[model samples]
Target: MTPTTIRHACIAALACAAMSASAHGLKPMSDDELSEVSGQALLSLTNQTYDGLDFTRITLGADIQLSANLSKVRLGEYSYTARNGTGADIDMGLFRFGRSDGTEAQRTVNITDPYFEFVYKNAADASKREVIGMRLGFGSIAGDLGVQLNAISGSLLINGGAAGNYDSHNDPLGGKRWDGTTCTSTCGLTLSQIGQLTAGDASGASRDFFISVLRQAVNFPGVNAATGAPDKALEGFWMNWRDRLYAPVLNAAPPPNLPKPPG
Candidate 1:
């Protein structure tokens, strides 16, 4: 081949290699595949009874469908079988389900290289740090975080201040308020309830701050399961917390004798 042609070929090969190296593990589930998965997950949960509550048939919600996302959205709806302590049937009409496994084949999280702001939220005490660190649990929590973070409709639930849940106000991945979603009457968690999207860069900036930190509380750096393994939180966290809370009476002697048995 000619010199110019050979050089161009080399450049093209290198570019292809780079693109391949930057790929993600997210893949779009086929309709059938999603259906099967959703069904399996739903079935596994059916006929199960909570200690104080009983629910009726579980069925798919209208919004349950595949998205332009790596994860599938499986919304489900159900109501109570009978009145409980509340004295009424407060049907959990619809709730989102986490369906993505972290082993998808394309379009996934670039967790190692995400552009993050060093958001320094105050930790009220050492317990908060322990709690935050422990939350990055393995499949139990971190996998779920990965699934949610990559969801097209990922949410950030505000704990109070009349904010039900910031469901659609965040970016598909970063969970940032992207310029708009007007909340004239109610800034709620559902799409129908949202007022409008961020109008422009300036408006978006303000909204980003508002939603990113509405009723702000303690927040720490979020751990990405894709980057590193999460810690075993139950034992590790509890023991550490106990040490911090309890005083050490070093080299203390045991009781002199076995105390009389309790009556």
Candidate 2:
């Protein structure tokens, strides 16, 4: 082919291509059409069914650092058996997580993939459906925790008590820490009454921490307040979501307990 003819043909082809591209620039999809499309997101939601229950789980794909403090906290106040007839499932004067420092990373609790799971019973039948339980959880966590328990219904277990750690100065019932020498007369309580508590997991990683509040009343076996006998009492159900809780010393002493519960 001649050079002139080849050049002319190339110019015509380029013009045709530009015209076709302009004719089909872009078009917006309608709402109906867009609904058919699928996409991925940083957060995912899923529904699962197992054992006659339905669960909706929301998972996040990110890390979080949190430093929180609650001066006065109360949950499930319906009974009048605990804390000298205070009638609370869990009541605390102070609750704190993590620590504050000049650096933000150092001051915050490290958490990964925070999630919320909602559980329902008879989900398919709305008339008979009910929310059985819901929970907020972390895939993993590493942080510091401090708490001042004024009143509680469930039992708490702490490890390693070597006397001098528990006393009855703040207790109204004239409680005393048991010393071997005092076995002749006065009975004293130990720092930990529920025995040693295990925290974290077998792999030594602190993971799967969650707090669950159930609709049903769960029985917590504990010493009877009136008879001091081993008995199980039904109270609002609550689940713990921490590694371990250290006992705070009373009376504002060195290494004192968290601030007192708000009146």
Candidate 3:
């Protein structure tokens, strides 16, 4: 063929290839396709795990349209429950991860919701740090140590041994003393006992303090006390802080107010 003719042929072929690509949408690399290219099918690729029994795969026809409804059908999973005496199918596409061989991986997509979200950036975010510091200050004041003067007095007095007195008479700044009882005998009370005696001051005040500190550090608005839990607005902040700080500390610390619950 002449040079001009060959150039025209190449242009037409390129256009056809582009149109084909656009029409099919991008086909994600399935296990087989991934194995072919990468030489291994990496299960749990999304750093998530699931029981193998929960997942099933259905192949899709090449001609299926790329609309949302069609995509949902392609990713749907069947559900059966004995209790309901009914079988229902759920859209598996709602699940961002899927399992094969009991291992889960994130769906290959441009956007996905991570099962565990971590915000490393918030750690260095200056505004977050300032907010957290302020929150911690409030938390400290409202906490057991700050609110329960009796507990503080008890702890201090008991630690002071024979010198323990409530009068604060002879020694102005010195520890208080109890005239009827000597604290030296009972001074060895466990930390849990101390916590219990102070518990009435604020139910989960210590925990709230820690949570507040974290919220301030990450620039999260205050938590809703009425909800008895962190609010949804703090979800992202909590997710990030928990992964980075809270989880690790809780794992390391002895159970809060521990020594086992009273029988």
For this target, which candidate reaches the highest TM-score against the unseen true structure?
2
Order candidates by lDDT, high to low. Answer: 2, 1, 3
The candidate that achieves the highest lDDT relative to the unseen native structure: 2
Q: For each candidate, what is the lDDT?
A: 0.25, 0.49, 0.23
lDDT of 1 by residue, 69-165 (tens): 2223221112453212122111111222222322341112111111222122225683442212212111111111111211111133322125434
**How does candidate 1 fare on TM-score?**
0.17
Model 2, residue 210: what's the lDDT? 55
TM-score (all chains, Cα) for each model: 0.17, 0.51, 0.15
Model 1 CA lDDT for position 49:
24
lDDT of 3: 0.23
lDDT of 2 by residue, 1-263 (tens): 99999999999999999999988997889999999998657798978675456778788968887667767777766644434334555566666665443244435556777888777777566778787767666666665545555454333233223432332322343221111123222223332232222233344435535555667532221111322212122225343332343333322211212333468
1-263 per-residue lDDT for model 3 (tens digits): 89999999999999999999998997777798777664323222222112211111121212111111112211111244321111121111121111111211111111111111112232356555222221121121111110111111111211212333222122221212112123324333222122111111223222222221122223332222432432221211111111011111111212222122357
Clashing pairs in 3: 52-102, 131-216, 132-216, 132-217, 164-176, 164-177, 164-178, 165-176, 165-177, 166-177
Residue-pair clashes, model 2: 2
lDDT of 3 at 43: 21
For model 2 the local lDDT of residue 8 reads: 98
* Best-to-worst ranking by TM-score: 2, 1, 3
